[model samples]
Target: MSFSLSTTVVSPEGEQLYTFEYAALVTQTSIALVQVYVELGVIEAIGSMLHPREIARIAQIQRLRQDLGLNLAGAAMVLDMAAEIAQLRAQLKAHQSRPQNELF
Candidate 1:
């Protein structure tokens, strides 16, 4: 969860710029891989709401709007999508943890 960024500048003529050397402390914690899988599933659900081209366009529009002090209706759409994503994630986790051989 923690990260660091480092930049190295070489010669101005050569113009070599290096940024973000990340290193995390390796810990052998007993974290469940299923939890990681569930998190990734939630992320994928959110990601699927936007096409690649729409993502690019949204990024550009957000940047331009921020620079020019403009507002749009995307916030509502994002909120709705977030709600749906949360519901789906909860259902997925519940289903994953359910007992398979329950008697009726």
Candidate 2:
């Protein structure tokens, strides 16, 4: 339940930043659970650490498991389907924003 407050890291793409340890602490989860989520492909990590987004996702999974009594596999499947839906929504938005002539 302890974390280093000053530890900050940038994602590999360098687009996201966060206090890696803080995220894990705030979520009340363990680094080991985070690693498990990575293996489940519910989240991706940078080496042994997790990205900010992945940390948030882990928190979501925790809530899902605690509130809804979902198993780890169910939480993983939900995360996967949610990610797929987000990707599809982004693609649909990009497609809609293009000029009508580009449809050809």
Candidate 3:
């Protein structure tokens, strides 16, 4: 019997972290690109590992760059704006949910 080794890393909180090499593989990009993304702040990494949420951000950036023909910086900017808008919408919803007495 043989056991296969896995390279995946998990935090105590159960969040998955990926190395640059593994993230590149998972994201279907090259290691160089991943490193560059990290350098350019397109993707934020905690040292050499990236959180699962960051993986989704990488995918979103890729989608924006590929589909909209935007550059990495532009893609990152768009995503940031989208996140801010989402946060504002959630805040608005929560505020609206409060009773009229709280609106003052």
Candidate 4:
């Protein structure tokens, strides 16, 4: 439920990462729901931890599913397409900022 710029958590195994419990709190969902999102490929886990962005995406997916009444597949497709469009926009912006001659 709280957000921090850089919060580090130490696991009993001595690894530094965000716990699934924290991710669930941050996403305002349950651990099992987060796992379901991971299993469905609606979000990804880096090793065994979810990135902050992935957590946010999971929240977005939850909203799409609950508020908009989108099915799991539909929400996944929307998220995927949104990611692709964001990448394409970034590439276009980078290309636009380059020299005209370099575009050839």
Candidate achieving the largest TM-score = 3
Clashing pairs in 1: none
Give the Å shift of residue 72 in candidate 3.
1.1
Kindly report which residue pairs in candidate 4 clash with one another: none
**lDDT (0-100) at residue 88 of candidate 1?**
100
lDDT of 1 by residue, 1-104 (tens): 44344333444455443322210112221123212322543112121122233333334444444665555445335544766999999999988787887523
RMSD of 1: 17.9
Candidate 1, run of 10 with poorest lDDT: 21-30
lDDT for every model?
0.38, 0.75, 0.83, 0.78
Which model scores highest in lDDT?
Answer: 3
- Residue 95: error of model 3 in Å? 0.5
* Backbone clash numbers for all candidates listed: 0, 0, 0, 0
Instruction: List candidate 1 segments past 4 Å from native.
Output: 1-71
TM-score per candidate? 0.31, 0.75, 0.85, 0.74
Q: After best superposition, candidate 4 residue 33: deviation in angstroms? A: 1.2
- Model 1: how far residue 38 lies from native, Å: 35
lDDT of candidate 3 at residue 89, scale 0 to 100: 100
Worst 10 residues of 2 by lDDT: 15-24
